[model samples]
Target chain A: MLEDKNPQKTKLEQLGEFGLIKHLTKDFALQQKSTIKGIGDDAAVLDFKDNKAVVSTDLLIEGVHFDLSYMPLKHLGYKAVMVNLSDIYAMNATATQITVSIAVSNRFPLEAIEEFYSGVALAAEIYKVDLVGGDTTTSTKGMLISITAIGEAKDEELAYRNGAKPNDLLVVTGDLGAAYCGLQVLEREKEVFKVNPNSQPDLSEYTYVVERQLKPEARRDIKELLKSLEVQPTSMIDISDGLSSEILHLCEESQVGCNLYEDKIPLDPTVIAACEEFNIDSTLVALSGGEDYELLFTIDQKDFLKIKGNPNLTVIGHMTDKNEGAHLVARNNSKIPITAQGWNSFS
Target chain B: MLEDKNPQKTKLEQLGEFGLIKHLTKDFALQQKSTIKGIGDDAAVLDFKDNKAVVSTDLLIEGVHFDLSYMPLKHLGYKAVMVNLSDIYAMNATATQITVSIAVSNRFPLEAIEEFYSGVALAAEIYKVDLVGGDTTTSTKGMLISITAIGEAKDEELAYRNGAKPNDLLVVTGDLGAAYCGLQVLEREKEVFKVNPNSQPDLSEYTYVVERQLKPEARRDIKELLKSLEVQPTSMIDISDGLSSEILHLCEESQVGCNLYEDKIPLDPTVIAACEEFNIDSTLVALSGGEDYELLFTIDQKDFLKIKGNPNLTVIGHMTDKNEGAHLVARNNSKIPITAQGWNSFS
Candidate 1:
């Protein structure tokens, strides 16, 4: 539906693999002091002297994690990097380098790959992460992107999911459910375009939510913001798989149950409106809708006052004893056991 | 043709993505002192104090990189790891950890993934590298494997492609072209099996060549061997691409040239026999056939005596001034310009 007519199509075979990689990455200058070597070599060398290196990898497959019909290649590339970097930020690390490998089918032209790399370059430039090493190859069917994000942190500054204690306040950065609501708007627009090709999508009302989905930024500021507030999260995880699921992960990993208040869940106005228009419950959307890319964390009660009124932060819940189990206390004052409604690839 | 008709198949949907990852990697214990945290978190943490970390990544797509019709899931998993680790070894670094991410369609049973992970486990155990982090997801088509290897080395120990100078003696570890010949044998056998499924063709004669393709190992010993000999290579690269292409890369990056002697190119007797049977020139196979995973390097001429007559090493060529250009001195004393005939995914 989004196919461009008379698009300049340069066959990928013209450049081959090495030529394509060089052409795409030639402009990326090494900015990080930790990067001793970036690209060109068989491996990229990084010197994180006396610091802890955090590494995370994620794979995005076409028709599974994304659809090209709606996802622009640039946005796809940008989102792919964001997904991996979110993990690094979740560890309270400063993302320093990333390696992006992509496998494309013959259907894509060289220009398409250039657009994708442009997005990657933009992300690396903005995030201050060096594009170190990657492999480019061909897939039999569709495009597949695998990204590994590497970051650095001091030993004492890192946080893990297993550190939360009972009575700790659960906090989340930014509002939830906007990205999911944005996807709904896009899917509806896609359906409309399929029925009538000439129909143009009017996404003005969904600007915030759609941007949240298409160009979501990793919570790179959270680490600094928390530090400025003199608040250190006892446990942290990125909200990629919805709030309830992530809360459960923190609870299970830390061996402490959580009382997630449904009323306290933050939702953007656009998300609330979209949910109402789609006839879906906003609270349920916040609970199960994912791709928020927000930081979900817990801090000691003593530090709660330091961040109580922060515009970007919301106190959503509190930790409980392991025997209490993870539950969502609804506005109606009834407890609902939280289950993993996260997206399951196999299912 | 190699399908197991009555094999038990466990549906993957029974275990979601996280469950599958946990089940597959449950046995992988952290062996590297640099590894601060392995799996189960958002990211893996490593403390590479005062050492430079080398990182490399590779993606293997089904049908493009391997034909599962003959390639077992186990070998594919093992080979994927080897391909990435080879890059680390090429950098003269000790491989310390790897992150393996995979996307498989529902066509593969849970048992198939288990089989693949078993091979990964074996590689990790044998290589003494920790399995740090990975993401498990579903693809729309066939299986896809992406691995990122992380290693470390002292500042001066790492070798790069841009260090070869004029008069440096070119060297290679182990025999070449065997893996390419092995692929040919496997392909021929696959065609034969298509004609007669019940014919149990004995592969004893093709054992060496076939194993070279199916279960190739990265040259992890070459670094230690060179250290023991007190011979340091000025430049090095792994033979993922053909020898000619790798040599060209070294020459181009180092601003030098080389004259690779055809007669000195190491090839196993089995490879020569296979080349003869296939009616392909042994020289061309050794020059352009890739996936050898051997270390190709250049050492200063002064260090030749240290590696002279070593069984594991072969002096195949010598670096020349950049104005001389790269060429192959054929057996009859004819110098032919080298070209890249390495595997091109787009082609």
Candidate 2:
């Protein structure tokens, strides 16, 4: 049975500009004490009281970040918000609100924008953050999405990735490589769909992987989990531009070295399978895949037992002496120096 | 000796990223109590206290908002930041910090980037706003600049464009049409250069006009001036998209009509000469050339007495009842309805 495409979807012109914004952020709920107020004002109210705020911004250009051919506008919208929240999480703060600025072309009908906003709203609902305010404009070129996320934590509670000490345990939340595998599956399916008009993407088997890529979650829970575990990490950073690149950032900041254990790295079965099918090295995929939004922190050895048996937590390695330099050990017990291939949009 | 370039000039590479940031924002002193911390942290700290925060974003794409051939990199960078700061200033709040993201191709050598940053840093210093953080990356096409400015003020202190009431006075700061005239001078110079490669622009006479376009200020001084004058505008907005377009936005929000006297409209001598030279309607150019960044505000009739004698403040007209509709009273007594040819990038 063919799905019907409705010809009479509501046009953006039907509702005025303010109406569209109100409709888009109707269900967002503020979830943190630091958010004295969220949205409905000239600016989002961030009453950090005595706490410090962590702010970051990123831009995702159309045709550069994702192709609309296979990537749904809704997923694109959701992922756009995710990438920015990832930076907030990297600073070990709870993201409370975001400003989404989107510049769309005339080719995008009102229905398309609505679908995209629906995805943005859904992510907001799940993340428990407010949409607050943003600027909507017409773009001269392709679609442009600019997101700025604001978060808050106590001045003393905030964790930076540059405070690691020697012997601190290196731990990562959640397994890696699934998102990269998901991307591979999507690219292959896109090619297949281009060759045929009637074929639907065989995405059922790749659901886990695809979701990891298209609708990845920020580690908001990890912040809570770490709190309940009573473990204050000496240093923390989010895994975004590959684990290797992020590890280098931590090393550079701390002025120390690290030794990552190859055997200790965790991978899901679907990720393993996709790596083999794509002829990609699983280890490299895990290290350089990026977009995982997982927490990579250095914890005191004394607190290791608190999260020792937790399935979601994996002890990847340990910090080394300052002169040892950063390296990763292979399965054969040979140490290899780390190199970075961070995300470079300009290229 | 040809002084086209100086090798002894300060090089940006010598300072690096953090040093450049410190060098740029070292002089900006936070004037608002809500600004808990201006810079030196992951994000600029804001303690909104009992007020609501209003945030707005703007993105400028190369070849759309500017023509590099007619614009200096230093001025373009400064103007870009000023435009975004103008938005926050429009809300009548203190603009404390901003996040800037630029996408440039490899064609922009490190020196070119340094030039851009120097301009941005200079603006940050002049405006007294901190350069908190931003992302710099490579672009597939031309340069794209995205800026997000955050500001805070008490809830009642915000001067929304919708707050105007019947019989209110409409006022504007500084003169209009100068920027448009400046743009014309640059375009003419560009044409002259194209005809004869050895030709040099004779721009000394157009200094004020050129500066108005290239290094336009965000009217931060007006905020302080307004406070000193003890006038809280009932309605406020920045002049960017044109006087007609901005006045209409205020009318639509405030639900009031306005009667603008044609003779009272501010204009510089350079604007008059350039408009005459270009055969462009002075009124139309003043209404729609965009990028002035001056304060367009409405004050209650009772408070008009305070600013009536001030040189910087000019009374353009008075607000009328909604039924009267917005119109301009020409010299011949002809009434022309106001409409928006607002700056829409796609259009």
Q: Judging by lDDT against the true structure, name the best candidate.
A: 1
Candidate 2: pairs in clash: A42-B54, A43-B53, A43-B54, A43-B55, A346-B138
lDDT of 1 by residue, A49-83 (tens): 98999999999999989888888989988999999
Interface RMSD of each: 0.6, 4.2
Q: Which 10 consecutive residues of model 2 chain B have the lowest summed lDDT?
A: B1-10
If you superpose only chain B onto the true chain B, what TM-score does each candidate give? 0.98, 0.89
For each prediction in turn, the share of the native Cα contacts (below 8 Å between chains A and B) that it retains comes to 0.96, 0.30
Docking class of 1: high
Evaluate candidate 2 by giving its C-alpha RMSD to the native, one decimal: 4.7
Q: Taking the candidates in order, what DockQ does each have?
A: 0.93, 0.31
Which ten residues in a row are the worst by lDDT in model 1 chain B? B1-10
lDDT tens per residue, model 2, B1-347:
11225566454444544444555456555655555545443344555545555566777777767888877788888998898889888888888777777766545555666667778878877776666666665555667888888776676677877799999999999989889889889988888989998987779989998999998988887777888888999989899888998888889879999999888999888888888988999988888888888989999888978898788889999999999999998878899999877665534
State the C-alpha lDDT per candidate.
0.92, 0.78
